[model samples]
Target chain A: MLSCKEAAALVSESLDRKLPLGQRIALRMHLLFCRFCRRFSRQVLFLRGTADRVRGEKEGEEPPVSDSLSAEAKEKIEQALKTHSESKSKP
Target chain B: MSIIDPSKGKGETLNPENWGKDYADYLFRYALVRLRDRQGAEDVVQETFLAALKGKDQFKGLSSERTWLVGILKHKMMDYFRKPSRELPVSGLITSEDPPEEFFDLNGKWQVKPSSWGDSPMDALEKKEFWKTFEACMSVLPGRLAQIFALREFEGLKNEEICNLFNVSTTNLNVMLFRSRMRLARCLETNWFGKKAKGE
Candidate 1:
């Protein structure tokens, strides 16, 4: 029987890649009996979905984008662009 | 006022000067979400613009300028993560330490069981405040783990690609991803789901 630790690792691994048939059955059996591992699996999946949404994967929903470049950083980037543009336009 | 007819391109013109004013925030947010560092995000955005400027003549108007610029931004992010110096040293711990111990015991059993987050946990995704907590939880992860997690969850890179990118065996990569998901799940429960359960 896969222990909860082994079960949890499989739970996470399943998200990244397809587990082999034998390990898949073992994880499924453990998840069937282990409510905690089941919840862990769901929450791990949820974390991915939530992250995708926040990264603007889902359309029509406004992501809660809280950060922005500071004024100094913006100015610096603008200056760099200006200098490059002028140098290119010259010789 | 420009070499090309800026107004003739359906407002998707390649005006490098106005790019910082127009797309800087959007591009920075895009990088920040994946990179999760303010300074790093800023640097990538700058690089993206510079590259876009250098390659403006190649713009074929096949896509919106934003989409084209975002394509360049994606490449910039990959290059940023690919740097050898940026790879964290803690990656070695994947071979040296036991990670599941954070939630599991030495007997390979769960030390702290996951609690029921109740039905419709999806509802939290719609709430703006929940994202605040989510970002907080994401930030709680160690840098390398978070980067790997972001690459998987946010960028949707396949496991094999990430393994090659990080130069880790699949086993080690899985362990790092497991640790990240476990910590994020635990943190969200403590900060968001657990709080909501108590009617907070």
Candidate 2:
């Protein structure tokens, strides 16, 4: 019987790669009896969903957060770009 | 928008004039979220614009201009993460003690069973404050661990690629990832879900 600790580790590892057949069966069997592990599996999936949002790659939708540049940073970038263009245009 | 006429060969015009108006805010926001530092994020955004200007002719236009700029910014962020100075203190993470035993009991059953997040994790994700809390949780992680998590989760890099970048064995990388995910999930549960459960 895979302990919850062992099962939880596999839960995370499974996200990275394919678990072997025996280990998969073991994990599944463990999860069957363990509501906690089931909740844990869901939590891991939730974490991935949140990560996708952070990456701005949520499927078929706009990003959840759309923070804009700060006004000061905007001014600084504009000034830098202006200087860059002027220098480039110079002989 | 009028300046982007492909037929006019204005596609070759890598104008810095419009970059700020068009892409600066978006890029800044992207960097700020990941870097989690206003000054560092601003610096990288500026560097990205300058680098894009220098290499603007290389913009094949296959991707959107924003996409192209984001590519530059991603690389810049990667460099920042890779810096030795940015590397977090390697006390707990680098040690052999990991995934601490307390997560399971003597018989290997859960010492602390994870609680359900209730229905619709999506609903929680949709909230703007959720990302802020998520960012806060991420910030609390050791810097390198957070960077690895960002590269995997945020940037969607393959484990193999990250292993190569960090030059650690797959085992070590997986351990790091497991720890990172566990920490973030627990933090979110405590800070976000737990608070919500209490009607906060």
Candidate 3:
């Protein structure tokens, strides 16, 4: 018999697809009889999808092209490229 | 829209410039899932690609190119989560002193019976708004608890790994994890599950 507390912890893991096989079955049976467990499971799935949507929206917004990288990073890239090209030409 | 990897010498071009939309789309979604913030996640993803381009030598192919990019994204997220306020203290999680094993029985029965719900479980969670509300709730958690929950739950890292990553003792980890789960459950209960007590 699982307690409400323990059952709740498994709910998130189950949705994430990480629960063990036996525990998965146990959870399924438990949810069959438990309203709270069922609600929690639904909520977790809902949360994953919603977060995904907001995530998509974020990536769609971007900083200007040239301004994206820092002055230091730009210099480092040039240095790496120069050294790599130079190294390839070594006899 | 170009995804250029200047350090990329002689391999298939993952240059976002050529596959800019696809690359950016993929990286953006990956970071967004973890950060739950659109602009912040995008910034991290962009930084990740730039960093990857610079340190292309660091990759030895233990994982796929995508996974490698995600690994870099994780480090970026670490910085985002490590706020100065995270230096604040957290109160105790459990005064009950119950062992984790107590949550599970030798015969594998739940300590508390689960309550039956209306129709299908999917029906309850089918709405996008439910998740929006849930994410909103999670974003407000105390910084330390949030880290512990994300690492252990989403990343699926082991207890030992979490200890090493966060430098906390096992007892401390247990308390933190227990607290994280409880607070998250409470949040979900309020935001998505409605305040109605079970079987009331």
Candidate 4:
């Protein structure tokens, strides 16, 4: 059975699928027999999934979006850019 | 999403609008993720374009065009984030646990399983309520953790990219990423399994 430290380390590598075959086999064998390790593993897997889901899920399943800027903000930047260019060209 | 490109350089040779769709959107999304605002994304886009134009003569045959453009975007973002005025917020531990013990019980035993629950995980994931529960648990996450988790896991950006964007050292980034994964596991246990514990 994998020790707690070994099991914990595998949790993140499992996220990336980077564990080597031998270690993976060891981890899997340990997970098969250990109830507590099994729950810990399940939680880690869930976290990765939730992070992705929260990022992409829309109220309508449209898509998770990082907030977009409003039109007014875009216009403000444009005006600032114009002013910046004007000053640069003058001097 | 509707495509966006500034009209200022219309019909002109030196313009990002003239770039391919994928490249433009990649930079735009990257900027959007970092700045967390649209107008800032646009200005970053503009700055990237202008920088690319000014350095157009330096485009050696070495790197691909898209890669070069991304490099400019990186510089723009780094400059923006590195500005002295704003502090970069990092995540803090809540309901802290001492190392080694927090991770493992007194007898050096795991607190929970590493693999799965009695039910299918994919099923739990598909439910809207499950996500809601997860999000509520997550929203209270420290601002620093939210960013690291979003970039590393959600955005699928590399650790190196995160290190570069946040100006965090590799060890610092690794620790942050570790804490993030650990914190998420703890939250999931509380959100999904703690009820079962009460029943038992």
Better of 1 and 2 by lDDT: 1
Number of colliding residue pairs in each model: 0, 0, 19, 15
DockQ for every prediction shown: 0.69, 0.61, 0.10, 0.31
Among these predicted structures, which one has the highest TM-score? 1
Interface alpha-carbon RMSD, every candidate: 1.6, 2.5, 9.0, 5.8
Question: In DockQ terms, which candidate is top?
Answer: 1
TM-score on alpha carbons, each prediction = 0.90, 0.84, 0.49, 0.54
Instruction: Answer with 1 or 4, whichever has the higher DockQ.
Output: 1
Off by over 4 Å in 3: A1-91, B1-12, B18-47, B57-67, B75-119, B123-126, B195-200
Shift in Å, residue A13, candidate 2: 0.8
Q: Which of the two candidates, 1 or 4, achieves a greater TM-score against the reference?
A: 1
Runs in model 2 deviating more than 4 A are A57-74, B1-15, B105-107
Candidates in descending TM-score order: 1, 2, 4, 3
Chain B TM (all candidates): 0.88, 0.80, 0.58, 0.50
Q: Please give the fraction of native interface contacts (Cα pairs under 8 Å between A and B) kept by each candidate.
A: 0.73, 0.76, 0.04, 0.35
In CAPRI terms, model 4 is classed as acceptable
Using DockQ as the yardstick, the better of models 2 and 3 is 2
Please state every model's RMSD to the true fold in angstroms: 3.9, 3.4, 9.5, 8.2
Question: Worst ten-residue run, lDDT, model 3 chain A?
Answer: A59-68
**What does candidate 3's lDDT look like per residue over B149-173, in tens digits?**
6666565567877676656676667
Q: What's the true lDDT of residue A27 in model 4? A: 88
Model 1 preserves the real interface contacts to a fraction of: 0.73
Evaluation by TM-score, superior candidate among 1 and 2 = 1
